[model samples]
Target: ALSMPHGVRMRRIILPQALAIMLPPWGNLLIELLKGTALVSLISVADLMFQTRQINAATYLSAQAFGTALIIYYILARFLITPMMRWAERLVARRLGRA
Candidate 1:
């Protein structure tokens, strides 16, 4: 409350702290969004999942097709999305002085 007694403190202090705390859950939401996009295949949108299904239909190899899809999705989430989220969380934590 030292600076301006009440006004700018919320913007300067509270919002950053709140964002730092909320980022992990927001990351989870991102992962969920990635999974949710797979549903777009139902509408004939040729997403990864859709193409995997197509491969399965053509080759009659559900295990190989879906297994490859699962591995690719895992790699995307593990290597790409997860590290980005971790970097964001660390950046926020550092900014908030909680690192």
Candidate 2:
């Protein structure tokens, strides 16, 4: 894990530095994953976006479906991933002062 024998901990080396280093490539992968989610309708997985398409087919609300899918992705990225990343950074920072 390469934890420091001195005051610099592994998380300091990893979280702010390693995570930032990996995030660009990870963001690209995340974008690709989100794009693939659009294809879920073909498999009948019924995720938010897929259900939106189902709603569109049943009703005439294509906009509603797209809007809901957009919200779902926004919530996942903003509420879920971003906060987790921020927390990880903060936690690592806090621990580094002691480590």
Best by lDDT: 1
TM per prediction: 0.82, 0.54
Which lDDT value does model 2 have at 15? 51
Clashing pairs in 2: none
- Residue-wise lDDT of candidate 1 within 1-99, one digit each (tens)? 575546588888887888998999988987887776773455576699879888998999999998998887788788888999999999988888888
lDDT (Cα, tens digit) per residue for candidate 2, span 9-35: 654464566664565566556656765
Q: lDDT for every model?
A: 0.83, 0.65
Report clash pairs, candidate 1.
Answer: none
Candidate 2: segments with Cα more than 4 A from true spot: 1-45
- Model 2 whole-model lDDT (C-alpha atoms): 0.65
Model 1 misplaced regions, further than 4 Å: 2-7, 39-46
Scored against the true structure, residue 77 in model 2 reaches a CA lDDT of 73
- Candidate 1 similarity to native, TM-score: 0.82
